[model samples]
Target: MLRVFQECPELKLSSHGRKMAKFGRATPEIEGLVVASGLSPLIMCSLDTGDRRLMSTFVEYWHKETSRFHLPVGEVTITLDDVTSLLHLPIIGVLHSFELLHVDDVVDMLVELLEVSIAEARVEKIQCHGSYVRLSWLHDVYQMKI
Candidate 1:
């Protein structure tokens, strides 16, 4: 699973979407990788969790029914090197706010989710705005540039 996800990090990997595609099986591998990597909880969150619809094939099927309001959504930009650079170092950070709705808000929720994931993963930056959400996270500092 880790191998495949590592190879194709962008593959939609929502187990709730449907029967796992032959190639989709890699989705679960992320959990094992998180454990093996011994990364911080934030990093683990990034590897283990993702937007349900991000993993689903049908765009319409992806929606955050649990969100109370238009979730505070944002795009985050981060670098693997920036994070991995802190190996064995204690992590300190906070969660970014998300404002995306659950129903009929697939793209909005995904963007918000990605932002949260970035924060949990110790991302250093975020800029989710405009037509395309732009979020960036780096290591060393939690410098959110939204």
Candidate 2:
């Protein structure tokens, strides 16, 4: 019943690689805090269909040992944030693209995507040229070519 919208990188920080200790700890107290803060929007938004079931489900999702969230639509991941935080790096955004790739080409495509994502200062138009990939945004371009 889990829809994967994003995938987590196979990287581990501690023995409990799947578990996000900080977020897991924070999940339990989020509801109470949001409620006590008089944030009706937060509560209402989470409580879609006027039922608390969805909100509880989201909270449960957050409490999972893994950093993936499975909602009715698709999965959401914290892998980017996790990776960036681990490296003490700052991130402005994340960009990912998926297509029906041939089995033999998927890994190569993924690597290319990651390279393009990292090289570009900002994400915009992503174009592929033979063995090279290009990413453009407004007028700024990255130093990496291909």
Q: All candidates: CA RMSD in angstroms? A: 19.9, 19.2
> For candidate 2, what's the RMSD?
19.2
Give a tens-digit lDDT track for model 1, residues 20-80. Answer: 1212222234446655545434432223455664443333322346322221253233345
Candidate 2 per-residue lDDT over residues 11-127, each given as its tens digit: 222232222222222223444664454442322222114445554456556636666786566788877587455544444445535455543353344345334343341222234
Model 1 lDDT-worst window of ten:
16-25
Off by over 4 Å in 2: 1-55, 81-146
Error of 1 at 82 (Å): 21
Q: Among these predicted structures, which one has the highest TM-score?
A: 2
The list of candidate 1 runs beyond 4 A from truth reads 1-90, 107-146
How high is the CA lDDT of each candidate model? Answer: 0.36, 0.40
- After TM-score superposition, the amount by which residue 24's alpha carbon in candidate 2 deviates from its true location, in angstroms, is 30
